[model samples]
Target: MIKYCIMILAFIVTGTTSAFAAETAVLQDAVTQTNINYVWTILAAILVFFMQAGFALLEAGFSRSKNAVNIIMKNFMDVGAGGLVFFAVGFALMFGTTAGGWIGTDGFFLTGIEGQDQTWTWAFFIFQAVFAATAATIVSGAVAERTKFTGYLVFSILITGVIYPVFGSWAWGGLFNGSGWLEGLGFIDFAGSTVVHSVGGWAALAGALVVGPRVGKYDDQGNPVHIPGHSLPFAALGVFILWFGWFGFNAGSTTVGDTSIALIAMNTFLAAGAGATFSMIVTWFQFGKPDAPMTINGVLAGLVGITAGCANLSPGFAIITGAIAGIIVVYASEWLETFVDDPVGAIAVHGVCGAWGTLAAGLFDTTAGLFGTQGFDPSIIGVQLLGIAAAFLWTFTVSYILFNIIKSTVGLRVNGELEAKGLDLHEHDNRAYPEFVGSDEFIEGEV
Candidate 1:
């Protein structure tokens, strides 16, 4: 009897210990998942933050010698100004509490948020802050030569504080809390095609229009002039950096740590490569020569096109989308230049390609991916069109009003003589390369 009792006691104790161990293991796993998500979110934010450098370099390279420093300064200032504005007001308007699915009204200054989950909040803000700066910087390139430094600073504040945040609220502010009519209608932007890209693109269009074409960009007959950017090598470097940073821009949109990230990164690269290749071939065939600038823009077009559907589509579909974007960019650039006179192909790469990316989401979304696989919804397409239209009208109208106001008050364009001498010497009172005067660096050697 004693032996039997001992045996039973031992069995009970062992079973209890095993159960306790299993429960502990499950709890540990949950904690680990939370920590992993925190780390990934921070990492992705850092990557997107670095894209500012890419933009700085790209814009600086494309600008005229007189405006190089001004271009770099504009890019830098936008980040600083936009960051402060977004933190103070933009974040609240974008991701705060929902009000009739229009805008947010809480989370101002990132206040009252606590715990590890708050890391996700910070990540979202920083990533979006960088994007807002990007949109503002696009206008910098468009209004490059003549825009006053002080005026550009004010515009940056407006973009991050009001313009970008208002639109962003509609699409991503959680106002829908993930179930609003627009979200329910399946307006799957995945990333900001209309929200970020088109916002910037349209603002750029407005700035270009208000500022007018660059001096000598058009002849007496109104035909477009071909003024090459000062530095091809610098432009190429900028393109590569942007391509590298895009891995984070698109893949990071998953907003979570998962195996899906790998797939998203792959799709990003595939689309960019396909875009570059197709643009190279198309330029060679159409223009009778392979154009470098078009090829770089092709890469950007592909990246933009893939961004809206990167998480929702197959790699094959991504490649197709990118190639089409590449071709579209070539024609769009030509057409817009003829009609609107964009200086840097911003309208083509960001504006036209952004629309294509948004529309592509409706057509190419597959149900087999991690985000889910529901192919081609007509309703989604309609919603996307609405989103696109809303973005264009809102951005254009706001920007037009802002520019006209600035034009009337402070004047948008500089004096004709100041422009003729280049804004660099007249506005900034400095030369990009004073030491390179009469040197090989200043002369065109061999192309």
Candidate 2:
């Protein structure tokens, strides 16, 4: 009897210890995963923040030397002023309590999360703030060279604080703590092709239309003049930087430490490669010389086009989506040149490609695509179309009104004399190159 009791006690103790050990292991795994996710999110935000440098270099390289400093300043302000606006008003409107599924009603300035366990909230905020600045900055490139700094800053504040957040709420409000009508309708824009890129692109379109063309952009005969960037090498390097950062933009959207990120990163790589190759081929065939600018923009176009579908589509479909977007951006850039003076091709790359990407998300999704085992869902395509149209209408219409208000009140553009002399000298009280002076005639003749 004594031996049996001892054996029973030993068995119970061993079982209890084993169960406790298993539970402890699971708890440790959860904690480790959470830590990994937190780090990844913050790192991704840093990469996105670095994209501001890419924009600065790309815009400066494309601009005339006289306006180069102004370009750099505008890029910097997009992060500085724009980030503040997003923090104060944009975050609340985008991620707060839902107002009848249309907008956020409260939580401005990050009100609710105020303790030791909200580290992830801070990480998420920085990531989203950078994205808001990104959308606002696209307008700077579209309206570069002739825009009044004061007027541009005012528009930047409104875009990051009001226009972007309102539309973003409709598509991506549920990411943290709110619901949106579009997401409720089953809309899918994994990394914000429609929410971020398209919204920025359309606002850029409005700015280009409202701000008018550069002084020497069109001739007396109404024919457009060619004004090439001073340095293609700088622009190419900018593209390279943006490409490297995009891996974080897409794969990091998972916000989890797991194997799923591998496929998203692969899709991003293949899409960019295909986009560059096809764009180069098309330009070579059409222009007899490979159009370096179009090819350069093609890299961005592919990155924007795949953002919405990178998490959903197979790698092959991602390539197809990117190839088509590369073709679209080349034509779209040409089309905009006829009437609008967008110096950096921001409208085509972000707006048109963003729409294509959002649509591709629906078409390539396994549950809704013809390419998959299941038959395509028409409603999915319909929702995507609706979201695209809604984004354009909201961003363009609101942006047009906002730009005109600024134009009338504070002056949207620099005077003709200042524009001719270069904004760097007169507007900023400094010049990009103190020793070198540039004029339109000189730029035209390559003297």
Q: Each candidate's lDDT (Cα)? A: 0.78, 0.87
**Each prediction's TM-score against the native?**
0.92, 0.97
* RMSD over all Cα atoms, model 2: 2.6
Off by over 4 Å in 1: 1-8, 112-116, 175-181, 368-376, 437-447
Error of 2 at 249 (Å): 1.1
> lDDT score of model 2?
0.87
User: For candidate 1, what's the RMSD?
Assistant: 4.0
Clashes of 1: 3
For model 1, name the residue pairs that clash: 366-373, 367-373, 367-374
State the lDDT of candidate 1 residue by residue for 1-447, as single tens digits.
999999999999999999999999999999888777667767776777787788777777776666677788787888988899999988778777757767776777888543325656776677778777777776777677767777677777888898888888778765322223355456777777778888888888887888777667888999998877778777788889888888878777776788999988998999999999999999999989999989988999999898888887788989998999999999988888875666568777887898898888767768622234544346666888888888899898998889878777767787655665665666577778766532212232221
- Of the candidates shown, which would achieve the greatest lDDT relative to the real structure? 2
Model 1 residue 391 CA deviation in Å: 1.3
